[model samples]
Target: MDAGLTPVRVVGAGPVGAVCALALAQQGVPVCVLEAQPETARGDSRTLALAQGSRLILERLGVWSRLADVTPITRIHISQRGALGVTRLDAGDLNVPALGYVLSYAELAAALKQALRDADVAVEYGIAVARIGASAAAAELATADGRTLATPLAVVADGGRGDDAPQPRFERDYDQMAVVCDVQTELPHAGQAFERFTPDGPAALLPKGDRYALVWTAARADAERIAALPDTAFLTALQAHFGGRRGRFLEAGPRKTFPLKLTWTGSEAGNRVVRIGNAAQTLHPVAGQGFNIGLRDAWELAALAGDTPADALGGAAMLAAYARGRRADVVGGLGFTDFLVRTFSNDLGPLRHARGLGLLALEAFPPAKRFVARRMMFGANG
Candidate 1:
């Protein structure tokens, strides 16, 4: 069969899968993407914060130039709710153009969709992977529509949870739901971001153009209550929790809620099958780490085909090298998000004071601030 006819299959056409397909197509490797959502389906309204490092990778894949309506993040402010702990990071201090950028899901999806068209990467809409079967030669993708696709490599980027997964994954339900929405502040964001940790959970307001995209992570009960709030009441409550740092919360758009959890495979999937993106790992919205790490996953996986023949795409050698190259990053990203969630969601007296002092120290000490800022801008290695 022609390689284009049996292209490496990418399950789930979300950012990760789309990036994977495009990266391969850019390298003259054929790819087919299976998207569960229909062409006309509405995108989730949540906004994502793309780190500086991710921008470079996207540029390499030729996706960044296609993005529209992005809001840059030049500085970040961090604090504990109603506490003296405060730390600020500026792009100038780090000597970078911007720390990050905020983008709506719809804008990003549209960009990737267009890129897919330009690259002529085949995408089958409304086709979800119901199950996967692996063999010595190819990975079998069983679709919900009762069709089967056989390909040398199968990359699963759908958010985890499948009985058909090749290996066991550790799961942690935070018992939290994130309330996402857009809000108008009395003061312009000026490309600044704020993350305030309440005893309940973490709340982050990222600059989105002139407004702010609010991601409020709270306990399930609290999230439900917050979601049920009337517009006037919601604004008041948000103002109280976030304080007046960004001035008053003038108005808000519609709000949505999504449960928070961390699901990650304990090890790599078996031969000829690989999982990347949320299928391999899902993180809390603590530091906006999930998609960035997933994008890197897509890029690394694409690099495996550099000088190798098409027949060996998912052969033992390729899969082994991929696992070795990715394990450290997977471990590091998981540890990074988990630590932020635990450290900030507590209110114990000693720990509270320690965190406050730590924040003070972070601001006072340039080296420590640079270390944390670098990690945020890049990854664990920074």
Candidate 2:
């Protein structure tokens, strides 16, 4: 290692990367964060339904308190468009304060960034990692700025196609678009979130202060058409599709749309390098599993890294243990979400009934419901 070298270097400044950096810094580890963009870029384009388990992780890292403008999800109500079954999970039944929370992406990113600054962690902004080269002893990150950062260990949190990709990724276009926006409803959300499965796809309404942040997934062509509708027409159409569960959607803000996809890869940790967050895998948005899983990845990696000897920051044994520890949760999260999207997205009559019955069964079986909630809350182990 070079004299006075940083112990760890993390790429990407998104919530996952920021939280990962904060975890290490909280452990008194010397680390630096590199962001592709300069400063913190705040956005209101999307909202995240953070699981109860994720709040615990963020709280442990001291970033949770920094977040504001979030609304607790007291319950999660699940139902199908034409089905008679309905399943609802209540936080009170589980003796928890909340099942989840609706957080705007900007709120989370800002909180983590602020926590990073307070910890005196160094963050190099506007520097993108163009390439990463690893050896048994050390790792080097080459940047788009024609500069290089050599460190004892490197954690890649940046997500995208790259030269040294970790595993073979499987991707599906899903032929869907997730149209997102915020709206005011005639009926209050009352801290409850709803997941309604339609013939075309799934739509979610999450409590966001006085409004509900709507993530309505639809077939690609339908999404384009819906997105192009005027605000009044769109809200009316949304109410028609979602039914009168929330009475009616009175008004809607501007909307945005993005193609939905299932892009996932395998886990890897070796040669003085590790990957976490979106760099590891990106799952379908159903069930809101991707970010929660990524948060666990960051937390687990930090715990392992915090316990390692400085001399073995990225040594084989340490890297191996990290890889082993994350395998179950990462694989489990990927499998769970993949299975869910495949099963529920189908509109066939038998499959539809099966899915509805599955929800009904989930409600009838307490143990089963608890098990699923725990898994969603705490990942593989829960």
Candidate 3:
């Protein structure tokens, strides 16, 4: 509430929200972040595959160095189930330090929050949003505690929900659950990340130091069964499904499961509000693009706002520009991930043969491998 300070309001304190705040605050803009959670938690078991572009954003925010000790993804391996060929990509191929880094979600969030604190961004914690309304001049946000705050622009980083918001949307439920957990392996992962497409779903193993973080997508019933298995039993099941790609699965840490879905929000320009991050789109995690895409949205919006006048930050003109800039990337990413999930998550004979052949072709062609590598390291949108 300082005089002469340009005001921007952001909801949610997860990665996207935190990164947006950091980006804006770094550019000398005053930002207020409303987070429902009181205190940022640590040791969030969810692991994230940070693309090279995402790393650059974090580095700009002064967060990558603090996360270096916990983030490591030196290589990536992709293959189709029951297929004879596999493609491998190393950071050396791209001549980059590393293709990407895998870090704990909670750790990254905490790091960003700390950076925000150091940058003096005001964060109102433990307050839930009660209602939101926007006008041409400013956005009014009412918290559950009955406090109303107004700002020139309001960015909703909250996860997907279809309500009275002005943004039009498209959504699809995959009827799948991603069962995630950290596991201890007998062999070192050697900083290699695995994306294995099986009949049930796409399972990813991301390197986390001496162990691996597992994201297994499967039917709800199967996910429930897998979640119920004992540590040793789960390891056996995992070994049977994953094979020796990384190494023998020794033991698993805590396990959790959540439904997977694909969502997209239409342009929010005509209306006086803008939705960024997961609120704008929630992608299937099969490609590890969910958080990466969200971060890109946040960074791009922040950059646009920083380059524009205060009065232009969240206005129709600015929001329209943002929507136009983000549309292609968002649609393409959603389509690609959804296609892979549907193509690989079944045993249909024709589609199976086609997808397997596609994988083989990519393995045989160096350029194809490079294209996939580039897309994974730097999103097609980036």
Best by lDDT: 1
Residue pairs with backbone atoms closer than 3 Å in model 1 (clashes): none
What value does the lDDT take at residue 10 in candidate 1?
88
What clash pairs does model 2 have? none
Q: Which pairs clash in model 3?
A: none
Model 1 CA lDDT for position 342? 88
lDDT of 2 at 100: 89
Better of 1 and 2 by lDDT: 1
Tens-digit lDDT track for model 2 on 1-382? 2237565999887888888888887776788888988884674578898998899998898888878788999999999898777889999999999988898998888888788888888899888888899887688999999988888888888864456675546776688889999999998889999999887888999999999999999999899889889988998899888999889789888889987777766545668777787777887777888889889888888888889888888888888898888888888887888787777877798998888889989999988998888888888888
* Ten contiguous residues with the weakest lDDT in model 3: 159-168
- For candidate 1, the 10 contiguous residues with the lowest summed lDDT are 160-169
lDDT of 3 by residue, 64-155 (tens): 88775465677788887786557778788778888888888878877887888888888988887768887778888888899988888888
RMSD of each: 1.8, 1.9, 1.9
